[model samples]
Target: MGSQSIESGPIPACELMPASILISWHPPTTADVTVETVPPEVVEGENVLLLINSLPKNIVALAWYKGVHNMSHVLALYSLKYDISVTGLAHSGRETMYRNGSLLIQNFTRKDNGFYTLRTINSRGEYVSKTTTHVQVYTTLWMCEHPSISGKLTVESVPPSVAEGASVMLLVHHLPPNLLGFSWYRGVFLSEVREVSRYTMPLNLSMRAPAHSGRETLYSNGSLLLQNVTWKDIGFYTLQTLTTDLKNEVLHVQLEVETSFSTCCNSLTSAPVMIERVPRNVAVGGSILLLVHNAPDLQTFSWYKSMEKIDKFKIAEYSRAMNSMTWGPEQTRRQKVYTNGSMLLQDVTEKDAGFYTLQTLSRDLKIEVTRVQLHVYKPVRNPFIQATSNIVAVQSSVVITCFSQDTGISVHWFFNNQTLQLTKSMKLSPTKCRLTIDPVRREDAGDYQCEASNPISSKKSMPLSLIVLAF
Candidate 1:
């Protein structure tokens, strides 16, 4: 093997030569010239060293060529008198030479595979020596056989909502073992999905101006923790992961950042007023009523979406004189107002998730009555549990694994209708995918259940009864 070349331009000779003509070619008739045998194989992207076995001590010049027939096929040339080395344009970045009658080629690509010839001339010009060697370079096995991706990828944000200047953590789950690296992007909502900032995993310490630069830490488990998060950090974040199997997956998470100081009617409300309870969880195409409470004397009521600041935008309103409901231009299509100061939202969607405020007048003063938080999620699926051995002898080991089609979820195990507690005999994997019981006993016998849950919903698996035999 030889040193890798660092030059890049005009392609190398091996790349230009057709595979059909890379065969052995006779060298010029010179009885004194000796050529060394070619190596068996050279992996692509490795260095190659071509040696001109024996030559006179005082060498006037040395030339390394890709083809034996022409000077135009020269790969590198050296001038001993001037002590200068000029590499071929095609091999500029990756080729170098030794003081001795040898040539060093770095990162030998398949395009570098073929016959290489070296020529040396003594200062006296009395004798000239030339050697020809055949070089074979093969592509790396992994590159030749690109694997397909066969796993899932997900990202979870711990404490999805936070006040400005608070810390937040984003956790990644279900990353494949063959993963190469992952990248994170803070989405900028322009006309499209523009990225305001980005962060790459495996932490490039030298990178400047990265989104998470200086303020974020990446854990070995692929989690990112942001310290002192600000309103600038609010928006959708995307995580893109690539694996060695040539597979890739992208996940998105929305982050809501609130102000540290409140400007709304928090101080004005002397007592905790219960209006109507807002249903936070709703399925697609479902109906939800933002119930109004304790406002029997109000002449009129108005609903608004609380903006980031203290200001609000009216979405719907009710008039007591007309005994009718009126919606804003944008809300009339999806939202219906009731005479009781309540709002009915139909065909709920993920877009409906946010904070809403209801406002009304009390003694000529605008008073903010209640705030509602809404979330729309897809219906949860039913998951099931599987055990390696349902019936086992005392003192035997058993493994229980939970299975779910969902990507991001939390697994909870239960024994005899009670939440199972971790003990000396119980161990769970980091992702909670599997539970292991090292030694089973009579106490281990029960109705085992596994529940998989996420922020959206929870699904319980059918109980699998376990039996234990006496020792």
Candidate 2:
């Protein structure tokens, strides 16, 4: 045996190549042939290459068998002497053999999976070596329906309503034994449908689509699991199942996700109650709502301006049973309590930026209290940037100040329409309202703007051009 190099031709762009394997041949004694699948496992409709390694010298012919090393199941045969190749009985027109004794299977299907044997023949026309390997074929993405089944396939959620950050499973009911595959979709409409995942029963494999959030799991039983669900997940989900008989079944299930709250116990009663906060940041002269959720069956609920004694700071009160409302000493026409326990505050001012408490008294005399924090900020006015000099030489110092009429507002500087990046030579004042560059470089020359913002609103000034001389 001499040193021989076997190179493969250009593979199709769609084919996925497996890890490279090194092959070396020494003095020819006994043929030590080994066959391996480039990728032992492949998805249906993909190409798979069977690599033959450690070829012995004087190899006259190479033949491939589909299973059990039977001649009837031969896939392809290659004769090195005549430089000819031919397909065998088991050939499904998808198998191709390279001159180097390797085999390529195009559009591999489930029927092509299982044991494949490669047999090497010597110049004497005797089978020198036979190597076998196993290949796994997974199903591809597909959906079909024949509607031959009698009953309807339904999907049910483990819990009808799920809390935020909790996991839920959409279980399939009355699943047929002849199920071929199932797919989960996000929306009800076909035009706007977004596939979550698809599972094939024969392959016992699941494939995720572009809409997968990395929090979903598909089970073989045609169930889908979603973890750490959020408000955005509170919508309708559709499941479509395909059976072996070409029967199709579809079901839709709705999931509701709600925000959770801490439970508080009252000294007067042992019953625990939940309190929810609806924090709001309203601008001056704007209306705001201080909302409450999961309020107990109450006789009356009071909204107070502060957490002080309810009698002194009470803003308004509403009785659920009587369906009537009463104004407190601090309550004005602008402040009103709704029958649902939410309080609406109109024309809010800076003085309203404080904590407000909600005290509820149940019909059984149980008390539950919750607090909400309100922020009343003045709408930020447009800010302008003032520089010591619009034109400066490189390495010169420059001072730029951002000014806004609104107090308690944050100022941000932008360079060329982007957030300014502070260099080592740049410094900001304690309030960050002023920027000073001790040694401005040529790159610093650009348009600059200042933005002033409060919690409620923000405004940006027109661009100010700065020219820096390079020389």
Candidate 2, which segments miss by more than 4 Å at Cα? 1-279, 320-323
Clashes of 2: 0
C-alpha RMSD values across all candidates: 21.7, 27.1
User: Each model's TM-score?
Assistant: 0.42, 0.42
- Clashing pairs for model 2 are none
lDDT of each: 0.61, 0.69
Query: What does candidate 1's lDDT look like per residue over 362-404, in tens digits?
Result: 4345464555566666765666565654656678777776666
Candidate 2: what lDDT? 0.69
For candidate 2, give the lDDT of residue 54: 67
Worst 10 residues of 1 by lDDT: 141-150
Scored against the true structure, residue 252 in model 1 reaches a CA lDDT of 68
372-458, model 2: which lDDT tens digit per residue? Answer: 556688877677565655666689877776755566566788999999999999898755777888899988899988888876788
Error of 2 at 451 (Å): 0.5
